[model samples]
Target: MALSNNNSKRATLGLGAIAVAGLVSTPLLAQDAHQLIRDNCVGCHTESGTTAAPSFSRISEQRKSPEGWLMTINRMTHLRGLELTSEDKRALVKVLADRQGLAPEETEGYRYLLEQNTNIIESGINQGLTETCGRCHSEARFALQRRSEDEWKYLVNFHMGQFPSTEFHSMSRDRPWYQIAFNETAVELGQRFPLHSKEWSNWQAAARNDLMGRWRVTGFVPGKGEFAGWMSAAKTAEGRYDVTLTGRYADGAALAGEGKATLYTGYEWRAGLTIDGVKMRQVMAANEQGTALDGRMFLAAEREIGGDMRAVRDQGKTELVAIQPAYLRAGESTELTLIGQNLAGDIDLGDGVVVEKVLSRNADRITLQARAEGAEGVRMARVGTSKQLSALTVYNTLARVEVLPTDAVTRIGGAGGNMPKVRAAYRAVGYSVGADGKPGTEDDLRLGYMPASWSIKPADEVAAHEKDDRYAGSIDASGIFTPGDAGLNPERKRSANNVGRLKVVASVADGDARVEGEGNMLVSVQDFVRRVLD
Candidate 1:
């Protein structure tokens, strides 16, 4: 992506010049890509060049996913006090994601793990992984990254250097940390995941897509419930987009909004929106190949508390994009529809799925009666060779609800601060027992993640006395919380609804059984403003 403004001293911030210098993959978007870094980063990150902080060029050698870049920026802000507007932070994250982000295919097999907080301890995992990497952090932290073996080696060295006692840590001392990391694990990691792959390279070279049209959107926010909306994207400026979203929260509340966004790397998407007076932030990925745009949208100030944001052009090319419901109960029938470009044909719903007949067919939609007969896995349907679609045929049975992220944080608001109160977004995943009669075994069926009714209450004795119900915030049926403004009134001592620990609950009903999962939420005062005060 080429920025319209290329002559400013700050223009060097764009990867275009560097791409030409063969420093990295061809940059997709330019201009505003690295404005945040140019304004605050260059002062020490590059201007100092060889000081304690590494230069941007040095850091550019490494590749990371969108979340990885956010982690780095967050580390800097928290430790080094890097200042940036939330908007700038969002843009900077998008810029780095475009330049260094990993392709979905690159992080395959780990999306579910990275997405949900899974229990690796009692679960089957890669040999030696738990003892080595999992000892200090989550697999989600390491699994999504792509780096050359040497880069991985650098990481190992960095870890040991930083920790000093890493090798002597109980988990590593018993095992040869360096020997396993450098020889066996490192080699395995390198072979399985390398920084340079055709996936990222091709994605890097693709033309930036101008998302100017209507889109169909579906996603669930933990505290807000499941929402379906339509968004209109129109080009408002070079590389900048204006968006209008209209929809309804699952509770039947009207949802409507308008926002602005910047598209980077032909796929990395960032948008600032407002819905019902709540400011929101969106970090989504657009897959041109799949002709789909999907990512997360959350409170403008709190990213962890967001919901999935997915969209397809109100209409597109010869693509069999999806099969609603994605699965069916064996021996049961479901009326399935094909959503794609020029979707036409005798529908094949997959093994054990027989399209009773083509109920209807339009240029962009096709409907059929499909029956699932004892089918249990992914099934692909094809219309001759033009359309190949995939869906799941499974047994619809209540299993267990797996809450996502394990934990998340939401914050209280301040005096007229643009930082609208943050709401925690939770995902409820349902699973079916496998052939082994267990819910977690390899044979267990995946029912997918979804939204649920939300509830929140005090999680501790302190919260109980503080009367979190009246102070922390009130959680909606969708799990959204509108925190009490900052300040201590007669009801409290602290000068704010600044702090509270609450339990965010997601309740999902599977037939007659109502299942619920809980996660912790730390509702505190504004982080950035508080940091600034410090």
Candidate 2:
């Protein structure tokens, strides 16, 4: 993997060098973790006190996510020349993460980084920290850790010492960087994220949840459709599970898979599975109470092609979670599938909508032939005592159309690059202007996702002059954008890579009229270092 440009140099320093080797290794037993760490790490990270380096006790003073510890170990391997077998490195990371990991609550608001959600727009972070730390790497890197004031200050010194260029970076050169980092930023970080907390203590004391048995699952894949399923977990090893999922999409397409999951910090759930022969990965968190699992699942090779997942333990309680094909054309009949746990009882599709007949019924799902009539508005679907708000919408016509994400990004890769290209998916959402008679007003009704023809064009004059739309990428009929190849192209001016700034347009057929929606997209260079976090 090659660094794209000079701007990424500081980010590389902050995030550490990518581990080119020692990533593929045989798994070791959990009992060997301590021995592996002692043999490989004790020389520098001593057992008792700091001598050549910090002691294990000192290292234990800080808590971090598994990715954080992995980066630290990777840094040691690349910088300090600490050599270890792949198995040993993996064991060290697992053991240290278990022994000195953040509590579940401590990682809130930053899970997107761990999940590799690249499109998130970070906000609400302190300006001081953003200017000092986030300029190089994501704010999530520091936000996910707990440290003492002195440790935070020590980190600032370490950065400056290791990367002297930090003092000359854009934000650093204008201010007393070290002084502010040491006195104000470190103090604020310590106060905000102390090494000691009741949450951590309580989490440590609480019993870990056993993720075995069946769970009701619901998810929505963008550009695809909503799906409902059930997952079964069998204990394969301590803190590990073998999972099987069975379900179907709203269009009645079959969805089934088998995967393996490893639990960390008692709550974080990581899994890799092949669903319908397509490889996928899941980053979810089991609730402390052990009832729900919620997070994101995406393609292992293409992280952009995934969906939001929500699941609950199948405890035989009637719970309505979702209604597939959630929108209906007023006065038109359609098949509806209600998914949840122990689904039973009289069915109701709110007012003006009637269930013509029950197609199928089961403890986890219910299929019905239903029709909407007389009105255009959001409807709550009910099955017995369980009801889901806004589960279904009845719309007469679309007053306007909007792209799901107003802004997006894709990467050009696969020209002898280690990282594969990241594709961007789009969906056109239909809306009714509602009784307020305004398209963009609060009362506007969200009809739902609609099928559309997708196209691309230059976003601005510069893009047009550069012929970006011709070289950047292509949007297919299904609204998936596949970027052009990586590396410089002789056809392009200056031999630049096939990168561009463009517009993604979606056209939806609405009777005699065509409703159009447009979104901005940037076809950028490939990421060289793909870390566990970010």
Q: Could you tally the backbone clashes for each prediction?
A: 16, 0
- Where model 1 places Cα greater than 4 Å from the true spot, the runs are 1-57, 66-101, 109-133, 142-195, 205-208, 236-239, 250-252, 288-290, 316-534
TM-score of each: 0.58, 0.84
Would you list the clashing residue pairs of candidate 2?
none
For candidate 2, what is the total of clashing residue pairs?
Answer: 0
By TM-score, the best candidate is 2
lDDT to native, each model: 0.61, 0.76
Q: State how far residue 148 of model 2 sits from its true place (Å).
A: 1.6
Best by lDDT: 2
Cα distance off (Å), candidate 2, residue 53: 20
Candidate 1 on 1-534: residue-level lDDT in tens? 000111111011111101100112223245445444667787665533433333364355566765566666776787788887766666666667667777657655554332221212224557577788776655555767777787777778877777788899877888779888877777776766777889888877776677777776766555556566678888765456788998665455768888787665555566777776766666666776635687666554343455666777755455565555565656666676565545555566667777777787875556677777754666776653444355554666756666664565556665475544544445667677777777767787777764477777788888888777667777665445556675555667654455788887778776577878777777766545222110
